[model samples]
Target: MSHRFRKPVNIMPTPTIDLAGPVAGIDTHTDTHTVAIVTETGKHLATDTFPTTSNGYQQVTEFLSAYSVVAAGIEGTNSYGAGLTRHLIGHGHVVFEVLRPTRALRRRDGKSDPVDALAAARQVLTGQALSIPKDTTGPVESLRMLQITRHQLVATAAKLLTLIKSLLVTAPVTVRQRYATMTTTTLVMTLSRCRPPADVTDPVNGTLTSLKSLATTYNMLRAQCDELDNKITDLVEVINPAMTQIFGCRAVTAAELLVSLGENPQRIRSQAALAHLWGVAPIPASSGRTNRHRLNRGGDRQANAALHRIVLVRMRHDERTRDYVQRRIKEGLSKKEIMRCLKRAIVREIYQVLCLGRPVRQSSGLRSDEFRALRSKKGLSQTQVAKKLGCAPARISDIETGKRRLSELKLTYEEFLKTA
Candidate 1:
């Protein structure tokens, strides 16, 4: 059954404190922290600066205890502001991660660290910062950390690949061209079939040796990354089983979704809040009948990358995705419009994963076991798959590799009678 997306508001939160007297707002940086303490009567109780470390945390807590602070306002609790927020919570302080105002707020009041801190204090003072969610606690933190590390590794892999390609051009005899597409096993096999060219000059020999060392280092890093990725994927399966069940979802997509969910579901008010946080939520730009908002150019770029992986995978692997997007194209929707729809649907899935405490969608029939069974029973040769599907053998090879999907074709006969 299809599901409706929900942005769940905590229907129940015990407001234990009336927040009398004073409130403190904190702004943190890598090196230092600035905090503003203001009383109910608009008097400056105290403004203190502390180093952003364990010592600073101690000092901040001592300052809070002096005034018996009702609550704290902290800027960017999920990003730059997170360390302080978590630190304060660890020390038993009720903290609200304050949201920065849009450009309009800046134009009106001006921007400064003191002003930002005071604004955070004011948000708590006025009950304006009630929308923030609490951190999820433990397991989510592991997933988020794994994702951050994986991303770094993947980006490094790309640069390493470029280096490998360059070395291949300059030192072609050291490794065969076929090794370019092969993994370490196949790479060694390809190398074993050839020998280093004797035509190499002394300088070129040194360079080739360096390239070999680089390749060794690259393989080690890649192996380490793969091991970490495996652990992260396994952890995701345990923490959020639904992650393993979603249609068109892969291990990478599941890991990313888990990371984006963070340590707490309560940290986000709803799925729409998440969409906005990730910058997937479209904005209106209506004026004088122009009615066009440009592409979202902000939000957590890393989070968006995770979502993009999901979209690209769906576009390539899931026939349902192709049908939906193709239908949009047939109706003359712009590429951007179709992409927007895909992003929204992904956000909907994200909501399900977080709120329901499920890591992914239900299995339904989207299992590898089922996929393999269908493939075997189809009994369709490569030539038939290519001919009937109106594609070439190489293209058909890619589909089987799971690198691409057969475009504009019916399902193989074993699957055709199974479902639409």
Candidate 2:
């Protein structure tokens, strides 16, 4: 026997139940959002759909306001739901990130917009989802957009370079022989400067034209990447000069860390949270007589990569790090084990710098008393001094207190005296 299944029908308007101060959940999509409202005690009050636009967002707010919405759970706040989440937050609604429904639950309850929305609301009501969405209205957002653009340009340029090389391999022997021995940089420049014969009927002419075109594009992309690099450097320097001053923390690495942490690094709550966000925190893998921690394979892989780079640089160049590694090696720890420990330590160091806003000290050949005298004589506050010198106030304080070198100040006493 054959069976036919009917599609779910949406014939009912949004139901408004008699309840005060209800909570809402949203299942977000590209063009629309499904909202479910429930009372504080877990009673379903209403379910509605709204378009994903300014007017629709306002209408959803007004609809939720009718029931005195206390809080809301939203799915995909980083993606499809980002706009709605921003809208809801702007209107003072407490928003929680709702996890997607499990496959088991989907099988049992059947899958639909209303069903997922209801599930999200119930998840929030029962305290199942508790993550606060990231604040995307700051410098980090600007950095993220630039990074994404640069990444796309780089990928395109790489593909074009690969294609150019592949074409060179198959071109006429004379053409291939002329280019095969050249270094990549020289080859790109040579191809870009080529004057292809203006004859499409010839294979060599066609190959030369293609190579020249792609090489020109590749050079343009390289120029764009350089421009992006400069912008990223300036922005990172302005956002936190100390960040770039850290060992192995360049503009790209700093930007990745800032993007991973969001604007408010305090949202991390603790060192463990920071470690977990970077995916460097160890996971317990204990069973029976064996007790050990396994490497975490989740969290922001980009942030994890930044941490890895820091570890590798320190291992190769920093004397203290080298000594520590040797000690750990003597204690029977493998290189991987030592690296894990080093990554965790680096995470702690970066967390302090990023979250606490600590400044790095550079050498300025002057005594502590001279530094303090110069600042006081100029009638400048620590903040004013920090601003003039382009360092952190904490670094200024350390300089004056003899905890840090006076050379740490960007301006030496002689320069400041002259400016005064």
Candidate 3:
């Protein structure tokens, strides 16, 4: 018997019902969301709970129509409240991201959904919650999803590698002697090709079977990660090639920055704001006699990590950066201080590329299409070019089609074209 399975459809929300003015707030959770409507003067008008779903979001909007929502304060605009935030924004209601109430505040006010919701509303009315949530309906969103998946795949592969090594430690003597000393790639390949008995009653066979399964999983995840890397590179190139072209800013790093900036980069007012968002901005810890700044520990940690990577790479490979590091060290700055300064400078450069919209780097003074035309004029096929360059033909095709960016290869290709 064949059973046909159909996908569930999303019912599009209708036009929002209009009403008189009031502010709203929502306390969101995994299964349900609590909504509190408050008047202009901070008086609670109504409180209601709705399921966290398409229909529930729609109902919440309808319920809010009882009073015209001037602004809605929502916690977790990037997590549990994401769907509702999008729904509210799509319906033309202004939304503000509300921070969680502090423990002291919670203790004073008493904790409850209605109380929290009203707090959010009151925060908005008082102009406390001011941040506009990231607009996720853009290419940056796609990059974020890809980056997240790639991070998970890499993490899973790492764990599998660790598990495989751990298993080998306790593996049978013969098995350990046979496979333990190989490099990761070799070990995975050897284990993946292992032929253990179908019945795993024997300890040796059980270990071998487990190793084989884990090795295979590791290989699969690695392949997925590679595929995702290609996608990320292409997408980041599209979003802002200039960003990726910056020294030490690869596709993954660029994607992290773009995700943090969101689709609407303009919303990030200045380089200082950008630095603050990446947690690179120093916080003043001044007193009557002592004046010092401390490292900021807030903002998107992933973005901060990306900045750290860029600073590290530049410190190693970039001559100017190295010179700056030395100069800072001579000026009584420690390695940590040097890194912080570099991160701030890097943020400024990033701001120029992402927010100021720097022009994309020209590959050997030609666009992808122009480069392809130049190759055609030279009467050389992609395979011929790839062979001459000692790379795969697919790589040549990807570069020519703008699916990949190999700066060195492109320069070499340009020289080859000129000679041909």
Candidate 4:
């Protein structure tokens, strides 16, 4: 018979979910929320609304207290419903911070507020939603605030530069004459001194005033940002001193991991799980003759960015990482594939770092049973693993203990994520 390709059967038509207990479904909004109490039997016992305020919080607490809420699942936990989540979590609630239902889910069942809420709650309760990453510690919370402010200030500064460029592109030659190429400060000063060219009265001067106001505010924000940066820097030095010792792991990468992972890394159970959270893991997509995998595009973009920075730094300075890339190139893997493998290998490095119980030194002895087991299982000696991961062998110590693991513990919601 001629070879005939046929569509492979999907072993499982759907994802498996074995929810243990009752779950509360909450659809969070800026001003109001829709909450539904769902029983293990999949019945909605109660549905109600609460204002996004303290009194509303009290109302929710009273309502939630009546039922044995195994877990409360809320969408937008990081943004609109953050206050509500904090309130619930503060009251000893296991809050499953779920992503909003996908359009596929909505279309699959048809859309409605109730449907969305139920999907979110059930999704999380079933372990499909997993959870979002958040920090309850004071230092981590402070670091997050600082990062937000710093990022905002930097973005504003970038916008100012963009505006200056756009202005030059559109301005007439008279304005463009010599002042166009001036630096922002120089341009601001020159414009301040020009006096509107008399007859024209400088319509752009009014615009310039607004831009200058933005610049002044930008300066204030920059100062605030600088203070925050200093505080974060100090915090990183104290918390992740070993991470700083790694040649390619700069302060920014260190800060991101510190703020993202906080003092505890056990919150994320495994390095594989952590890789998904960092958006560095690859997912296989294969059926019959077609076989391929793709880099995960879902995760904390911020943490992913930090990982990229580390990789870039290592590529430039770390001989081991550079050589690995070169070898991978010789082996016929594309540059992107080489980087992806390096990133996953970083997870292994993270595992080793957390295992050794020492600072991030190039080589640290691993005499403990745990260390031996880990190394034996991976089939790499301490130094070999350290070199591959671009980290110190001493870091392997922290990886063994609960001191460190991976940053940003949120997993992706890919269709094929079990391998990850």
Candidate 5:
């Protein structure tokens, strides 16, 4: 000590770590959340359970604050973990949607909240979690709510209509005879207006009362659905007018597509990614000699249904779509195969227009010279072509002159010209 007094030595304090690659994993439930913190090296630091309240979310942030979090993996981000995910996101945290452990993994590890949370953390640490959670704090969320409500209302109305029909089928002769000849709209109107006796003791009165109640409820639900439809249409048009303008694409189908894309469409990455997400992309199932792809049954079924709806409508109404169908059929592609091809092509077009920020050009899959040459060879006049296609002559003229955008109409018109 006497020797050291001659020259004092300064000791440096340990530097505080700003962040050490700590990742948080949360297994969220309705009432509580099981959270685990792990480091980059896959060391589980701590696991804790917190209530799913604002105070609890705050407490969780405080607990994780001890070690600055680099990222978070959250299970059920669209369900139970939604609130926590939003909270974490608002607090400037990078969050990834973590799928639940596979049954095989769960069987091996045994199941518990702490174990699941720890597994999630470790998955994040190991770079297993990849999907970014949907941001629900936007107009897209409002559209989703409206779309879901309308869907439920429509379903309920359909069930009610079915039940009413069933009841009438078994009703007393007089009641059955009265409704038998009425169309669905007339039946609903008549049933809703019926004034059954207060005493439901009689079978006729009981049936009448039931029909009245169900009809009225169905009408109400139908009205609500119409209102929701209007809202959805307005919102979708405001969000992406080009999507609505696509042949056979209605607001409801567009809404489903938007919901699947989430608030950030860029997160979908590529056209192929979008096609895969919507189940339009085929999955490879190839072997040594037989190389093949199978229908993808795993993506967003709702979006897939939307695409199917669009395809069905286009097949029935769009001139170009009909032409494609005929060509594909002639080329030995079955109806199902043709549908798949159309969906894939539509997805590609949508991706180009929406995600790639390309101007929404009419997808005229035709060369003007070839189309004109085919028409000239067939000796079909533009007016005759317009009449055959049930379109304006000006439309045909514009198509020939390249003044108007026509989506795939050339093949159909050309086919008509050849056959004429």
Candidate 6:
């Protein structure tokens, strides 16, 4: 009716609306993965399942791209989601590690791929998941692979050795007597060389044959371990020469630390983070009037073992560390407490070397200035001396300062002189 007298009214076309891209969450499995896409405002847009294969990865990424994925949260970045995490990062998407849903949350929300994936996305959007996945393409990855292989080999050898020992317990008296006084190496060699009788009907012959077979397997595994050890040693020397230079850190120990810390040392936020990661950080157990911290029984046990080894070596041979232990003992600390302290301290020292890239000062009996001059004369950096001696550079400084000796370097005075 208004159109009868009103001037022509202009109608404005609805402006185009632009919504922000969605974030993605992945629930990874061995053979397949469930992916959920959620809008910036927390609305679930879609859910899809894909195979855990190269082509599947490509297809998943493509599907996410269609929805304009801004970021992704992936559960088990170190395990099931490792491949996808790598792919997403390589494609320039910001990726965050989504820890497994807690038992409480799982019970409350129930569980399904889409549910978990949605939860992961929510965690990412809300900043609940903050861990940056490790770069798995570096030398550290190679070291990890080798370390895992070596560890398996070692475990297998131990199991085989145990079986052989059990067999020997019931073995023929002649066989037991022959191996009883022998060392492990000697026994293995002897058993491996035994000429078992061809008569399978005889118990002794059967026992001999079984022993030889076990011994042969043990020897082969040992040989493989040795080869792996050499490879690990070479790789460690190249990856971080400074690691092997620490007084108590051998190639194996250094390799373990490297694996624990990853290639990018900066991934360890701080010395405290490292301590926590290795379970060397004491947990506060104080309640009310009680003031105390208890041993942390979490984190990487392998890393804890590595730190414990360093503490043992230092306690046995490091004068300063020995003095510290004595003082702590005089202060009425128990051995366990002392060990905890030592592990924490050792973690600090290792953190300095690994994370901060600093040389650890050893109590080696040498003047700092003298070591400096000697290093200068030899055209070596603190790192070079440490690498060559398989001890920390700070130890080299200590040796030069006359506060520490060269003995811990596994080198005689003459060898030191030649190297210097």
Q: Pick the candidate with the highest TM-score.
A: 5
RMSD to true structure for each model, in Å: 11.2, 12.4, 14.6, 11.6, 14.2, 15.1
lDDT-superior candidate, 2 or 6: 2
The TM-scores, one per candidate, come to 0.71, 0.79, 0.78, 0.70, 0.83, 0.80
Model 2: per-residue Cα lDDT over 11-89, one tens digit each: 1212222334688989999999999998889899999999999999999999889988888889998899989988998
Tens digit per residue, CA lDDT, model 4, 1-420: 011223322211223344566778888888888888888877778888889999998788878888877778888877788888888878877776676887887779987667778887677656664554364545666667777777887888778667755765666565566666678777655554444433335656544554455556656666776787788787766665676676577666667765666445555655666776677766566689977665579876787787777788889977657656886788788887777777777655664454233555352223223554656665666666556556676665455452543232101111111222
lDDT of 1 at 214: 61
Cα lDDT tens digits for candidate 5, 74-169: 999999998998898898878888879889989999999999998898777656435778889888989988988988888889999999999988
lDDT of each: 0.67, 0.81, 0.83, 0.65, 0.82, 0.80
* Candidate 4 segments whose C-alpha is farther than 4 A from its true place: 1-21, 166-224, 259-264, 350-358, 363-420
Better of 1 and 3 by TM-score: 3
Clash totals, every prediction: 8, 4, 0, 16, 0, 21
Candidate 4: lDDT over CA atoms? 0.65
Best by lDDT: 3
Model 1 clash pairs?
133-266, 133-267, 136-263, 136-264, 242-359, 242-360, 243-359, 243-360
Between candidates 5 and 6, name the one with more favorable TM-score: 5
Per-residue alpha-carbon lDDT of candidate 3 for residues 93-123, written as tens digits (9 for 90 to 100): 7877888777988999999998899888787
Q: List candidate 1 stretches off by more than 4 Å.
A: 1-17, 78-81, 99-116, 126-137, 171-201, 288-294, 358-420
Order of quality (lDDT): 3, 5, 2, 6, 1, 4
Poorest 10 consecutive residues of model 4 by lDDT? Answer: 408-417
Relative to the unseen true structure, what is the Cα RMSD of model 5?
A: 14.2
Off by over 4 Å in 5: 1-20, 287-290, 365-370, 374-420
Number of clashing pairs, model 1? Answer: 8
**TM accuracy, model 3:** 0.78
Model 5 clash pairs? none
